[model samples]
Target chain A: MNSKTAIKFSVLLLLFVLSCALSLLFGGSETMHLSDITSQDFIFWQIRFPKTITAIIAGSALAAAGLILQIIFRNPLAGPYVLGISSGASLMVALSILAGNSFHVFSDFFIGKSFIVVSAISGSFLVTLLILLISKKVNSNVILLLIGLMFSQICGAIQTALEYFSDPNSLKSFVIWGMGSLANTTNKDLLLFVPLAVLCLASLLFFIKPINALLLGQNYAQNIGINFKQSRFYLILISSVLTGLTTAFCGPIAFVGIAVPILSRMIFKTSKQQIHLLSTVLLGSTILLFADALCNSLLLQVSLPINMITTFIGAPLVIYLMFKNKHW
Target chain B: MKGEAMISIKNARLGYKKSGAEISVLKNIGLDFYAGDVIGIVGLNGVGKSTLLKTLCGLLPPLDGEVRIEGELMTQIALSELAKKVAIVLTEKIGGFNLTTFDVVAAGQMPYTNSFNRLEKKHKEIIKAAIEVCGLKEHQFKLINELSDGLFQKTIIAKALAQQTPILLLDEPSAFLDYASKHDLFLLLKKLAIKENKCVLVSSHDLDLLLKYCSKLLVIEEKLAHLISVDEAKTDAAFLRIGGGFI
Candidate 1:
């Protein structure tokens, strides 16, 4: 890396460290003094640390997935949610949560968590399979995007209809999950979430060359010896897994995926995947950790939904990117 | 000058396969391209110039017959193996996410790089050399979206140069270039062919420029491709007919 790129990376790294520290120190309603380390140990280790880790994993995964989608689809507006992956997960979760006692698998803690995760992943994969099949027939990226939107709309309609017929007791839990929370994950959940997120993110390194070639268009990428179909399959698969896992755990957090990638491009001012990947991941984690900290520190009595904070920040950044003259 | 043919096309039929049906555009083409040869492909719009280039570069398969590269059948060669042998520059505009001239040019070394796309010292030298040859040293770090049409065309040419392939194919490469850049482009192609013993094929509508720079001309008409030397092209009936208004 050149000195300019190194400086940019240093700045981002510094912000990431700051965000992590801020989150660990001020992440819960119960404020504790550092001097009384033993007295505050339980809250710090049990609650604050896990929430921070969850924010880091979910944020980085979503942002990187968004970046991959934007490059693969060659669309500026493509995001983790654009392909209806999140909606598919939401629809499945709604069936389990809102369908009342018919699916009583949610009664046990371990079974409930695993079942929710499996349901979300299966739902997203089913939708991804349908989209991949359609992609082979369509020639234009615009057409694929329209088809994805149509799928998302269809999934949303069904989810809404399910919600309409559910009981109020189950509806309350479903609505809370939709609001999104980073605090629900404990140490046990980290065993699965951490490894899967890391694997999906690391798999991207193998595709750095193909993805770079693809930026010039499919013809150029193919001319450079990339198997366009195979690469697309792997890229889409990685993105869906990342999106599915995050949505399953955190409940479809919004805007961080789309907004962070565009922000990284504007800051770094280059499209080299190596640099963009690092910056996007770091910036993603930093943004979420800071947002989560704000949710905890500002409203001590009532913790705000993580999605509300992210959309509030991410929406305006996206708007600003749209108006800017530089192409991304 | 012709010890062995670099590329030999044997009765190749070029066209698109739409929904499992072959739509042939040009047929019965037989030709031999040797090293140090600068050939220009000329035809009317939508007359299969691009299709022919695509076929030679392994982007599209011929409807029938075979294209042999270095004595091996084209269909038998893997795409990865073909990448080291041939490079192409098409007419399409590439819009990417803040891709700089340097980044795009660096991608040319991808076929040779490791899986991580690392650029060693030698790879960096090759990329720098290509940039200098294409007169894009001043704009090497500039974003592609910030470049003019002419410079953008030059950047793509530089990328093809960086690939360092034995055969280079370009389709309508001069379409977006200015007059001087177009002249420089042909001059560069000719230099690369003769000095480096590379086979170069370019397709364009610039008949005057082609006649001035190309060693030979391949003219397409009525689903037929006719190969003629530059001197013979001056008096060829098909060439005269196609260039009637201007030549």
Candidate 2:
């Protein structure tokens, strides 16, 4: 690592710390001033703490997923949302809601209860499997990306059909979940998400050599002794799990999955997977916290949906990057 | 010491199958490459020169027969293990054009690094030495995208050198280079094979450069392959028929 990279990493770390501090202090009827220790403090500790922790976990997971996907596909635009993994999870959640199921029940009995969590996990994995199968058949990267987009549209059509058949109460619940929120998550949810995310991220870090070699191209990577199939499978598996977990917890948080990695590359001026992963993690958390803070500060009557804020901030960045240069 | 074969292929048959149709590119080909030998492969555009290079380096599996590295089957060896024995420099431009020259060369150390992806002291020393040998120390910190095509070619060659593999395969290393750059590249390859004791195999369209610099030539004609000593290649009727007139 060079001094510039070290300095940039340190700055991102500092910003992450500040974001965590700010998130802890503010949110959902819990204002903790330095002067008073009241029920509000307890509320902040209990309610806001879990939510903030969930956001951090989700942000890191999604960003890492995006980074991995981009490297694997060799396309800058590849991500959980664009590749239909989010839609897969969303369609599962929508199905569960229509069946009058609770999300927490799925989290609890994910291992055994042949119902909600199992269905969601299988749905996500199935989409990833289809993608892998298609990638093997169709060697063109652009065609793979288009296939993913078509899958996303197909999932959206199913979701709409389900909504059409559901009653008002179930529809309302599904709509709220679709809007994406990090709030109301319990410690058990954290137990389910954090470990999986960490494991996936660790595996991703382990495959950095192959991913870097891929920057040169597949033939070159293989020539350098990187097993092309093994590395590609590992990366896809890790990315699917990361994206699946985040979409399970927070409903399809739009654009953060696609945007954070791009932003990190721009700011850090490097596309090395290691640097991209680290910078994406820190920048992802900061973006989420900052957007959540904005949502709270602006909407006095109602808590604005988290996805709306993320989309608002993220879309502009995507547009700017798209138009900036062809080389990147 | 003078004629020990570093790479040996026995009855190698390489090709691809599609729709139950097998197209044979190389049939029953066999050759031995020794250290300090600069070998050149020349053929028309579609004649499997690149495929042969890839197969010899163990990037592609042979349809039949085996490639042996020091008497070990290439397929039986682990990828990282195989990587330590042979390195290839391709003609494709690297995707991360924003990387510095040093970073691009350091990427060669990937097979050598441990879990944290940190290079060992020995790995770093090798990378530095490769940079110096490639004459790229002045451009070490320069962004790869900003460099001339000649520098980019050298940077890739430097990466292959840093790999420290005994056998090096280059696919059209001089394809996009200017006259001066091509001259410099051939000079560098000759020195690398002669002084550094590397068995180098390069594919090129410049027959003149290949004839002057390489000790042996592998000519692919009409989908058949032949390996001939460069001196005999001059008077051989088969070589004369294929060599034609232009470089």
Candidate 3:
């Protein structure tokens, strides 16, 4: 790495840490004074600490996922949320819950939430497989993008229709899940989220060579002896896994999945995935932590949904990028 | 250097593989490429000039007969070995990448690199020579997407050069380039063929200019590839009948 990149990385790391600190110390209540160990210290350690880590993990996973999708699809605007892969997970989880209720399974079940999470992940994997199959048949990125949007619409409609007939308590919880939150993940869930994100990110890093060659498109990549189908398959699998875990724990926290990678590209002034991937992790976490901090601070204790915060920031950027460059 | 065939096609049929059936694009192609030969294939749009080259490069397998490289069937050679034998420059634009010209050129070494794709000193030297040969020293660090069509064409050619293969194929390499850049590109190809002892096959719609530099002409007429002397190609009965102007 050059000196400039190293310096930029260091600055981004510092900002990430600062954002995490803010999210931990000051959220939903008075900022805990580190010097004074009061009852509030428990809130800091137990609640805000896990929430901060949750924000960082979810944000970084989405960021890397976005970068991978963009590279494999050869579209700068691709991401887990935008491609409807997360909605697929959400659909599966919702379906599992409704099925359990109809069978009276939830009444006797204590550990069924884990079953929902497992089903959600498999739903994500199935959708990913379907998308890859279609992508292989169609060479156009725009066509695949339209197909993903259609998948989102179909999946979202099914979920909403299922919600219409569900019980009041189930409906309310499902609605809350759709809004997305970083505060909901318990320390127990952290054991699941952290390792999965690390493994997927390792897969992302390992794919640097194929992804770099893919910049010239699949024909060129294939001609150069990189097995194109295998490369794309592994990348899609890793991207979906990351998206699935985040959707399972934190819900579909939109925008960060699509926007942070672009923001990193803008900041670094380069489009190399190796640099963009690394920068996406640091900058994605920094932005999400800051957004969570804003949620805690801006509205004065009544925190906005993390999804709402990201969409508010991200939607306009997507519009601006589409306008500024017809390349997308 | 101009002795033996680098690649030879024997009655190969070119076509598109569709669901449950194949669409025949072109048929009955027989040709041999040798070092120090600049063979230019010319045809009208939609006449499958690109298809013939794609078939030759093994991007699409021949529907019939065999394509042999150094007496071994092309189907028998692994993709890695075939890549080392032939390299092609495509005209398609790969935009939205933040890659520099140097980085794009460096990707040419992928087939030879280690799993991690680290450029050894030898690889780096070859990549440097390719950039220099394409006269891209001033724009090596420029982002590829920011370059003009002519420069982008050069950058893609430079990438093909870095592959260090014995046979190079380019499909309409000068299509988007200006006249001056077009001449420069062909001049570079001619030099590569004669001096570097590489076999180069280029397909172009610019028949007059192509005929000027090409040692032999392959004319696509009525879905058939015709290898004729540059002198005879100008007035061949089929060439006159097809009557593609600007020849």
Candidate 3 runs further than 4 Å off: A35-42, A100-114, A126-147, A323-328, B1-4, B242-247
Q: Write the per-residue lDDT of candidate 1 for residues A1-328, one digit (tens) a residue.
A: 7999999899999999999988888877866567535575778878888999999999999899889888887776668676777778877877766542586876876687777777777777788778767867886766886887898799889977876788787777677777888898898888888998999999999999888888988888988889887998898888888888888888878888888888888888778887888888999999999999898888889888988999889888878888874487
The interface RMSD values of the models, given in order, are 1.1, 2.0, 2.3
Show the colliding residue pairs in model 2: none
Candidate 1 error regions (>4 Å): A35-42, A96-115, A125-151
Candidate 3 lDDT, tens digit per residue, B1-247?
Answer: 4466888999878888888598888888788878888998877788888888888778888888888887789888887777788888987887675678998888888888877777899999999999998889999988888899888988988988999988899999998888887888889899999998888999987777777898888878787888888899768876655554534
Model 3 DockQ class: acceptable
List, in the given order, the native-contact fraction of each candidate. 0.87, 0.54, 0.43
Which candidate, 1 or 2, has the higher TM-score? 1
DockQ scores for all predicted structures:
0.73, 0.54, 0.45
Candidates 2 and 3, the one with greater DockQ: 2
Better candidate by lDDT, 1 or 2: 1
lDDT of 3 by residue, A83-161 (tens): 7888899999889888877776655433565666676778777887788778879987778878888988999999999
Could you tell which candidate, 1 or 3, scores higher by TM-score?
A: 1
Order candidates by DockQ, high to low. 1, 2, 3
> How would you encode candidate 1's per-residue C-alpha lDDT over B1-247 as one tens digit per residue?
5677899999888899988889999999999998898999988888899999999988888898899998899889887888889999988888659888998888888889998888999999999999999999999989888899888888888889999999999988999888998999999999999999999999998999999999989999889999899999878888888887679
Lowest summed-lDDT stretch of 10 residues in model 3 chain A?
A105-114
TM-score per candidate: 0.92, 0.91, 0.91
Per residue, candidate 2 scores C-alpha lDDT tens digits across B1-247 of 5555888888988877766677779887888888998999988787898888888778778888888886688888888888888888877776442577888888788778875557789999999999998789999988887888878988998899888888889999998788887888889889989998989999998888999899999988876788899887767665676667532
